[model samples]
Target: MADAHRPDKDKEQDAVRHPAELVAFSKVKAGDTVIDVWPGKGYWSRLFSPVVGAKGKVYAYVPAEIVDMKSDPMGIAKAFAAEPGYGNIEAISDPLAQQPPPDMQNKFDVVWTFENYHDLHDSFMKGASVDGFNQAVFKLLKPGGYYIIVDHAAAKGQGLKNTEDLHRIEEATVKAEVEKAGFVLDEESKLLASTTDDHTLKVFDPAVKGKTDRFMLRFRKPAK
Candidate 1:
């Protein structure tokens, strides 16, 4: 994390984001292939690229729905991948459907998305099936590979009710949905949790914007 090439702006948020601990928890190691789904601003991508090393690869996937948007997320991803010392990183786009391409199935060591799982349930994604998404994730990983999700926590039992409006989802809902896809719940972390976050306000509300009560979950595909 002390690498000089990282943007100063990204470094500033490390204290709260706990990139090192989360990376360790994910067990991403040198020579492992990783897919950083919907890697906005390339924050996690930047960290993963170095950890995965020259022999490793990091795919910064931009969902198909927003690939053509005015913001040009694909372009942003490409630009980040092209920066110095990031040769191991590449930018990939989602296919027309939310599901990953057939060639990508069973090909990765880790599939990780940070703070954007709730967006998959939002209308902006054009009704992408969360179940299909989870199943696709299951198929994408190699046996024993990891699936990591980090997102803001909503009130317990709220389920998808706050996903669109508050940009949060119930912790239990995520666990149930992902587990249905056949992943075993490996571990959960409170690294990003905030006791002061009452789980009522929108994640974007000024008071909670950067410090929302977030949940981190790790799921694993059985080697068998």
Candidate 2:
């Protein structure tokens, strides 16, 4: 039987260009409070809303620094706020690296970033520097909560060396940085791996666009 709390298969598939089946197979679950960091257009935010169910909450954290960018961050937040069946979701537009609001401290079960990790290095997002952002994620989760990241992959050894110019970061660099923030690298998924990408074009470049090679990483806060 289909899981009562899970989203309909078609609804999930229609939401994103990538195969939703592969994404849904990752370890997110119902009744888990989730944070979707920098949710561009709220695609993953929407997918997570139903999957986490009524008992769970999804917080769409949009860093305040970039909230006024040409990308229309406020419009995205407004759209998410107006969506149905997502009463538990909220959009927070705070400056990056600051602590989440008091009520949210140490309260989330999962904190996720999809395709936006590289933005941490962007000049406009300085307040949410890589280290500060990671630290905030660590502080927001429960002891055993999850930190999930999916991002475009630069060539191995790049070490975020070209993140500003190329907008991709080495997977090893991401793992090292997150591990340094105190999470245990629990698992990895190859569902989004693609070799056809030449690693030269920007992720938004029309050439490779939606098929850019990406790394899917899952980390867990160690239970104390």
Candidate 3:
């Protein structure tokens, strides 16, 4: 958690993002292969690299739809991977609507996405099927592998109503969609919940921006 190489700006977010605690809850360890889905700026990937150590691997999965954006997420990931102390990291991308490549199937110990899960339901994703994305995550993990999602929480009973406008999704809605992919809901954490945010404003709204109420869930692929 105190890695000196991490950017000061990224470290400043530790209070709200809780990268250290999230890493521990995810159960990532040395020698475990991890896939970081939609790793904008390689935030989580950077955290995973050192924990996974020399033998372990971290693949930053950049959705094909956003690879060519002005920000060039793929380029950022690739460059970060090449820097000293981050050799274990690699950058990978696939069409948002497609499953992972055959070689990637059942290969990762953990598949993680943070603050971006609701984007899957938004048009910005270019019609990517939420179900298909969940299935792909399921396919990417080895048996008993964990899939972790940390996203802004919507008002109760709203389902997908606020996704596009508010950038949030009902917690139950996410659970239902993911469970449909055959994962078992293993645990959840209130680590990012907020008392001030009323779940009505967009996550980007200045008042609620970084302090939005969020949910963290851990789902496990069955070992059988």
Candidate 4:
């Protein structure tokens, strides 16, 4: 279920705040198959639905553990099922450690992760490590498919050190890890950059909650 504290309407608007511009730059078009990983509150999922249109498909991939934590997982999934223009949309809750469903393998033109990469460390504590998550993303895309990530940025030298505490990761660390999965960094966008986010407070700290410094990375699965 959507977090009661985070209404669907608010979540929808927040999706428009920064990531929408990045998505536009991604050149996503009608008839493209897209996946929104860790689709918290279904914001990106909702956005992708219309962008993909009737002929295309959008899969909202939520980790199985999220569902196991509450009874509303299926309820949240069902909400998307009830939308009118989202006939091609689907909700998939697979264990984070596993690959995306076989039916989805090599099926997407784009896979997007937003404001959620830092949680990979948390996902690890739950048994699925970051490597597992990246590998799954790698396997789900076509050879030339796009994998886009946007997440809170840790201090330059912090590396992955405070990922668990601050829910942030070094951009360099993320770049290296994704490259190891055979993805090539295609582009970087500075639209979300903020010099004022001093990298000390937790992202959720009231002062910097909405304006946390972040890095945007676009990578592609190499074509054979």
Candidate 5:
């Protein structure tokens, strides 16, 4: 069920997010530190900030791989940090694939990426390694932590065939890649599933944009 205790501060930003229950899929509780990977404009970061409350923290990590790509990427994270209710949020950018500092190793309770996981396989994001990225995620998360991924879906078992053109990926590929880093597949959410999507057109197609078929996957670090 969707969390009913949402802060008034998050109502606006959280309303526009699709699936309406993505946060509920996360199961992140108060005082949990969450890492929002590839936080474009910090949308999820904004939503997570108030949920985690003053005792918790949210790290909006802008991948350094794209930091210099003419978009002035860091500007987005900086802007969110300056927002009124974001005191518990930290915007971080480094040369690695959103890896935290040494002092923060094994400190995050959750790490999530939404609508951006396919980009990690894009050729344009050169030198960015998915295995390296997941390994880093494994290192940063404490035992029993969670990693949630929501992204545009490609045809089953199609692998990376459409990653560049359609900006979508086969869910099986994602599972294989992530599980290689030792995370156990915990749960799956069909909240964003769409059968009308033929899985051929680019996610940007006007006909399917904003409603493209998507998959929400949750993986957990084992407690022992």
Candidate 6:
């Protein structure tokens, strides 16, 4: 381990893409609360642990629908939260629903669903009403808080028709659905956009896994 007094850059090191921009967009800071919705393996949660420091909290949610998959998604997050340095993070498991938990209402500074928004429409998720889910997310945020979404982009006209097969969604469909939930579209980033992706292959395909064209959207809860 390096010295506790290491330079900020050395302390802030990680392999995730555009970590700086993500932090900027989420507006996360010391003592703020946030959630990494369905945090598959807690990659973002780990990054957030120190940024939020001890006073803040990070909820690494594991949607009840995906818990039984071979990946054992929730196990990974739970183990990570049990580790030495990640005390600031917590593991939360619940079905995706329209109602925010009592303690979470108007409590989060940011609710991030990275590469997992399309799963909201997947078949196995109980109560996975995409619009209602978005509405629930709106309830989870504080006034002026942001709901940041990043997901694989499907073809322009396909909408959600291919979600089960391709595990992707149209960027426009994401925007329109979230807006209907009362969140305002604040910004869209092309940082992960890839014109080379043909949008035909499954997101898990070796040819395109991790390289699918993606969209990053930031939607804000009204301050009042």
How does residue 121 of candidate 4 score in lDDT?
Answer: 76
User: Each candidate's lDDT (Cα)?
Assistant: 0.90, 0.79, 0.90, 0.79, 0.84, 0.83
Give candidate 4's whole-model lDDT: 0.79
Task: Give RMSD (Å) of candidate 2 vs. truth.
Answer: 3.5
lDDT score at residue 221, model 4, on the 0-100 scale = 91
Off by over 4 Å in 5: 1-16, 97-102
Instruction: Output the lDDT of residue 131, model 5.
Output: 87
Candidate 5's TM-score reads: 0.90
Instruction: Compute each candidate's TM-score over C-alphas.
Output: 0.96, 0.87, 0.96, 0.87, 0.90, 0.89
Candidate 1's residue-wise lDDT over 1-224, tens digit each? Answer: 97777999889989889988999988899999999999888999999998999899999999887787788999999999999989999999875245657897788999999999988888878776778888888888999999999999999989999998899999999999999999999999998999999988998899998999999999999898
TM-score of 1: 0.96
Model 2 over residues 22-108: C-alpha lDDT tens digits? 346445688988888898777677777778878888888888888788988867866765676668778877767776666767788
* Model 3 poorest 10 in a row by lDDT: 1-10
Q: By how many angstroms RMSD does model 5 differ from the true structure? A: 3.2
Residue 55's C-alpha lDDT in candidate 1? Answer: 90
**Which segments of candidate 3 are over 4 A away from where they belong?**
none
Error of 1 at 30 (Å): 0.2
| Error of model 5, residue 116, in angstroms | 0.3
Against the true structure, candidate 6 reaches a TM-score of 0.89
lDDT of 5 by residue, 42-81 (tens): 6678778778988999988887888887777788788877
**Deviation from truth (RMSD, Å), model 4:** 4.1
Please say which candidate is ahead in TM-score: 1 or 5. Answer: 1
